[model samples]
Target: MTTQQSASLGLQAETKRSSVNTAPEAPPYCGGDTPARRPEFFTTVSSLLKDADGVTVAVLRIDSPPVNSLGSQVRVALGRELDAALSDDKVKAIVLTGTGRFFSGGADVREFNTSKTKVEPLLRTLIARLEQSEKPVVAALNGTTLGGGLELALGCHDRVASPEAVLGLPEVKLGVLPGAGGTQRLPRIVGVAAALDIIVSGDSMSAEKALRYGLVSEIVQGDLVDGACRAAAGMAKGVVQYRRLSHKPLGADAASGQLFDDARKMAARKYRGGIAPMHCIACIEKALSCDLDEGLAFEAEKFQELVNGDQSKALRHVFFAERQAAKIEGVSREETPRIDKVGVVGAGTMGGGIAMSFANAGVPVVLLDSTDEALQRGLGIIRRNYEATLKKGRLTQAQLEQRLALITPSLDYRDLSGVDMVVEAAFEDMGVKKSIFTTLDAVCGPQAILATNTSRLDINEIAAVTKRPGRVLGTHFFSPANVMRLLEVVKGDATEAAVMAGIFQLAKRLGKIPVQVGVCDGFVGNRMISHYTREAYFLLEEGATPAQVDGALRRFGMAMGPLQMQDMAGLDISWAARKRQAATRPAHLRYSRVADRICESGRYGQKTGAGFYRYEPGSREPIPDPEIEALIRECAEEAGIRQRPISDEEIVQRAIYALVNEGARIVEDGMAQRASDIDVVYVHGYGFPAFRGGPMFYADTQGLDKVLATIRGFHAEHGELWEPAPLLVRLAEQGGRFSE
Candidate 1:
């Protein structure tokens, strides 16, 4: 049970040789440690030419622009070139490499669902050809080699990589196992434990680590192509002996069995909601037990199954959704403004977090507060945060000091005059925010961008007080700003295009996913979550408990349950907001009083040791309380609501559909550019499960008609609280999806 596939492909017979070479022989082109430049030559995605020596050694370069992704055309071309090189009598050996920064980034993701992916000369066919070629093929990993790219290299007889090259198979992140021999060949080269670690984590390793793991033959410091060519020539001359990865024996024993068992446990815990890691582990186990041909077929079958599954579809939707969020209307063509220095007003919780974000990006920041004591307290929190990071081994002492040194805490407004951008993370009062903006407008430079960190306040009123309305917008960083990855860039009515472009670019620099949203009561995420949380309360009032509601959503892949999230976020925060809006709340609109009652008892949240649930003195774990359930029962009785036994399915449908219905209204209102942008805000900002995509994608998957039918039923039962959005009804009638 060796490899029937390899023999059918006409690979040379396997020869016994020592895998470990005590004194590894260098290639003929090996020079001094100095970085040497590769010989210049023009080449396309697939072209064969000779190295500096002569045409005796054929050199094939994959030169597709932006990372040589293996599309249909590239694969077909490489197949043809490989056949030609193998047929040429003068060509002794072939060296394969990439032209630019990446050797190959894997498959063209854009072609995943298209017919091109299934066309002739597929990646599998090309890699098999490389494995069976008469002439020895040396893979020159020029830079980053990932997914199918690494599989291609594994097919070659030998591999040489540039020192800066990074290699891995990250298909697991996208909810699919690597389809192109990655699972089978990788374990054969780097043992089972390392293979599981690399594949399960879906992380890239450095070239040095690749060499150490015997994944590559050598770490070529300079001129990757030249080194590969020399290595190929050595193999042709019998100076170097390399074995095919497929023919290697899988030393499966008790230890290997333990490794697979451990991998299963890890995948079940870390990636509970996804099926990709489990599939990856299963493929590796099959590879070890079966022959190469059977294992390959098994891998291909599993790959097809996972790729067509809902989880992969949802994950892929998220992949494209993030890219779609980057294109802001009327801002893509504008010249981005330079922001070298940042100023943060109100050195409280959010202000300190925002300041730390800028400082972490190596930008100098001025943190301003009204009193010296306030500034000192804010600075102390930043120090403790950095110290925690250092203790976790995430940051060095130098890095902590450098980041801390970038933030200058002060009480004076004059210190912000020299900063390029000023963000006000003050209290969420219109008057208080307007006063700060007015002062910033008068004191700060005209070119500086004025931003507010208000999560729900109107940016227009805050900008109206300042003469430079065009320079004002909202940068709604989520709670604990420095740790969160979402930055909702709220566009004001008078916001300039350049200002939007600059902030978008700046968000990327700070390692955040920036989604452009129009100014409104809660913008995209919070506005939609309002409906979601409302439904959760309604469920509670009916028959469900906090633990029941949270458990249902958590099983559905949410990072946290709505009630648990409310408890952790402090129920009083939203209670105060509700009190402010109560004056304007419509008379007919249904409102739940359970949360208000909890707040009335002075139970804030984890901060106050009780809210939706009680917490221990030092622990933040939510402990279900019978007293809270009694209170909910009383509220329901007073509201004349009949309690019914609610299934988990009903709970999930009510909560998720609420988000979809509200998201539709937001899209119809043009607050968000597209449905995908709304999805991005939720996935990155609101802890919506990435595997389920976002509410919009989930709606599409469930079918708009089905969603509408459920909503219509809810509307009939719950009245205005569950009213189907006009957009949802329209799309359902038209048979259109949100993605379209």
Candidate 2:
């Protein structure tokens, strides 16, 4: 602790230690000839009993450094000062302020992890004293007051806030709520409707709005401590008016017949899997109709239930896990490379959208294509995207125009002169991609980065063509790039850290989540996706129809099943990639061998009016095609693979676990930095269900041992394709998560 802070705390103890461990009725601000007092206390809380002329006011200051958390020492010292101010006849109205910038910031977050150290009742007892004090208690909110901090201010008779202050109950965001009298006091003042809104949203309002909502009594601009002392003096002399929070009658619109019913339904829709918002609604309704004691009792009972629930635990885990993920393992703030100008090749759907993302964040972009017409079309796509944003009120016309003006589209390769980086979203063919890189190598500056948007290709080989191979990388973007959030940043064998750092910065600017991955055929995302589709195609080889598989996946919350998704994306695109891989597939590894056969039969998905299922031009309905089903049975019979009944559980498990097993392999091989990074890709790139957590988290939840056992069982029954990843086996044996 700082020397100044320790001295202030010592003064607090010297002034108020005599009235320790007690709560009592208080007196006015001062009496004649009263001695000025400073007390000895812990570094957490500070106090001084000063006489302004004839009136003495005990100022209880919470001084715990770094947010002044309402921890054990803070409660003890603060309770002591409240006791002295209430019992001493020499002391009149009390003033409560913080030593530094912040008032109490609620209970210490670290302390909440324990079961025994929570001292809410002790804090409440002191707050109850201030609420019932004969002498007025004024709160000086000088900073952001939240959770238990706001609850403490609620206990004061009058609240005076600094202009810079914002007060709210933001606890709901962290898997908990304001259990320390927030439910009772907030509804008491703001009423159930407004209080419930604030609680559910977890958004803090400004001091100005707080005043408008009657959350605080006054807004003081400068010298907040002096303003609080003046209020104490005014109250002591009967010069300024103040209202007690406890005596205020409840508002008429607290809860009518339709109010609570509407609340339950609304919460049901928005918070589908979430339980906190629903419990918050119930507590608010109880507060609306019940007495103060009854309301508090109900609030405590509900809090007890939610704090011990599984949903809270899950939400809390995700919260902390995300914080942990943001900190790069070996990279520090100083080592990160800055990105300025970016160049994007092809100027097609993905390239234009990707370029627009960088330009939107004020990064200069050079968009390259072969012809002026193609360049114009790409620029048109950028403008149309912004214009749509303007139409939707997501951006103002001027802002949209500014973003549009940031991009420079041209047909010449020389236009990429000073760009810090270039992402090539050219044709999927290796020959076409390699030719583009040769051109990029000749045109772009030596220091400039070159990245390809190839979904499934050898990044290392592509890097081999460049003079500075370390400057080349893979920046794979999903289809309709502007909409999707994930960017798989693939690092080649020779890729430099500065090149990666530049890409990471560019991804952040593009409003895309960049996850660093190692170079491989498909990197992390498409590699797993390829495995998922293989299992789906195999399911068709069995007795289960395509509709049955789609039904099962949709029931499990997938956006679309494999067959439907293929039709939407145009199956020929995947068929082309399949032919590339089919040339080298090992005889031992299981291949469904159904996709290309369908494409060869002139089924190019919805674009060509047929795929796994037939599609009518405008309508997406895939009517049961006897032709496809017949082909599946014929292929299975010819291959001597027996058809059997596959249960729904079997279907879901096979599809999910195939991807999970591949994800394990990627983690084991160091293709992905972390398992959570794999989860982020699936969550953003693929339509992975969030409620199940990510695939890795889901695998952990399902038990890694069990997942490994299942995969081993499949490997024994099937061939080499079902071979378990070493990481999965290790995690299973050690009983640790992939992230662990």
Candidate 3:
């Protein structure tokens, strides 16, 4: 403890003795002429405390639950307390602290797009009052202080934070920039470059790092409020002068044109079509050149624009959809079965990644394979993955070792006998999956939940081989499972509701977005993506070049074009799936043979250096190939179809609408719980741009009538291949959106 804190708080004797077991009594207040009095408390969303020391300093504790988001009520209460504290001559200093896990969660996201947010004493207005206060105001950051919360702290005269506190302005991720003076004040404290980086990326930094950057005045060790009280008392004694960030000069010259230019370029490449990141850079640049008030006005203007724009709307939809997807009706989390130990079958890429995910989440994993050699190879792959992440500075060596220690590799099924759950990520063949499940049923304990990681196989058929089919479900993790965020929890016809609920909880615990889907040839994501890729193939055969089609969708904000996506995923994989379906394919249904023909010619995408496009040695970059074009033309000729020029708009509509049409069918068939769940699957797993929402939301944005007209036009031209889904037709006729 510092000497000022010792004198102000008067706990030096108790702290120094070390042998005192009793709780230390409250010390005398640091005031002159007036005797100490008991604390007088006032309550709202926050609690206001007038200390006994002649009320020299007042402590306001924000008590909003969960994250202490600055809702309108909290803002109103805070405003009233600030007025009271400033008006009272006895209260010479004011200290602000949070009561729980968050110092503040920033602005209340739930209040966005609502009247409550615009109520009296807006976050901006409250911040202005905080900055303009005559008495010294100290912000005691106790925990996660973010967004408007950090902006609030920036406005205070002095800032102090706990060692474990994390600070950030993360509005960019929600497709907006900080509006409450964050863009202007942060640069003055952390410099323009750092402010730009932090705001653009929307990532939090540890309080220790904040101290190094001089963002915080002090790092309080224990009892954050008490330290803040002592600090406030010292300010009341005129030991520290009020520091206003707005009055401070920026760390860079306004004429340093290259800094902003570089930042803009980086944001453009990193965030692509994301508008908020670029806007954030502009805000920081404006802060460097303009006055504080002018910069704040500019920031608010941009923030309002984003809050009303389509990109922010889509991002917000995704945020809410993620929360809604977790709320499975009739399934309570309280009845969830415990999943302490997990077993991952197979030693291929998918199985290894799944094992790593469990280990990363601090869960013990038994990785079972058919042979010792295969088990060793899988473990080796997992170690290399961790080492690569370590090289990228995402993981420490100790963390890598700790996660690795949680995975136990074995060659025998008996080793998985004690596991509470077993995930079979074996080959995606029905016969193979059934055989694996049969063995698992025999070896695993009766309570073990059997999960299949099949991308497009029949979960019910696989479950039928097991004695306990009620406990069997499909937990489909996307490829490179540990890295992907989506978990398609496939609910089989006979799977228990409690089992699904348990898997839902487990997926969240493993840090994945679990979307419940019913059993089908290809669950929600792949089912919808099937039509998306099919349209891309049709477009190719209809005279659209790979570059033309891919470029249009990429510009539309898809992470990768369909052809390029195929190349990256290995064309042979889809070709195999197609061939498997060929036996059952309806004769009237038009099946494009372009991809299959490419596979037959020994062009299997990145794995073989050629598929829809060709690749150079050691590079995944796809180059347009004239040979593939010739092959596509040949297929068109063989199918007795005439090729015509296809426009980019047509290409995009065909691709995305195909997804919408299939998604509508999935929802109508009860294969997907809701339209939003399909959206969640696409956004998290399929690289669908969050800014556009998902296929279903995009359809709503485009209008169901327009989409229906387009689908009808395609159906007239291509017959069965472009048939409109029945649900789409109904919704269009009624002028209703998929969300309805």
CA lDDT of every candidate:
0.84, 0.75, 0.83
Put down candidate 1 lDDT per residue, 1-740, tens digits, no spaces. Answer: 01122122222222221111112111111011111232343233554555433436667778655566776666766777777778878778988888677888888776777787888888888888988877789999988898888999999988988878999998998889989988888888787778888898899999999988889878776556666776776677776675666554464661367788888898877775889999999888886777777788899999999888988888888887886687555544437788999999988899999999999999899999999899999999999999999999989999999999999988889989999999999988898998898899998999999999988889998999998999999999998999998999999999998999899888878988889899889999888888899999999999999999999999998888999999988898788888988999998888899999999999998999999999999998999999999999999999889899999999999999999999999999999999999888988887788888899999999999999999999999889877888989999999999999
RMSD to the hidden true structure, all candidates:
8.4, 8.8, 7.3
Count the clashes in each prediction: 0, 18, 1
- Model 2 lDDT per residue over 97-174, tens place: 775556766666545555433654455666788788888788999886877788888888778888888778867665
Ranking by lDDT: 1, 3, 2
The TM-scores of all predictions, comma-separated, are 0.91, 0.77, 0.93
Query: What does candidate 3's lDDT look like per residue over 11-81, in tens digits?
Result: 22111101102221222111111122323432334444545234356677776555667877678777877
Error of 2 at 692 (Å): 3.2
Better of 1 and 2 by TM-score: 1
> Could you tell me how far off, in angstroms, the CA of residue 429 lies in candidate 1 after the best superposition?
2.0
Model 3 ranges with Cα > 4 A deviation: 1-44, 50-55, 248-255, 332-334
For candidate 2, the TM-score is 0.77
Candidate 3 TM-score, C-alpha based: 0.93
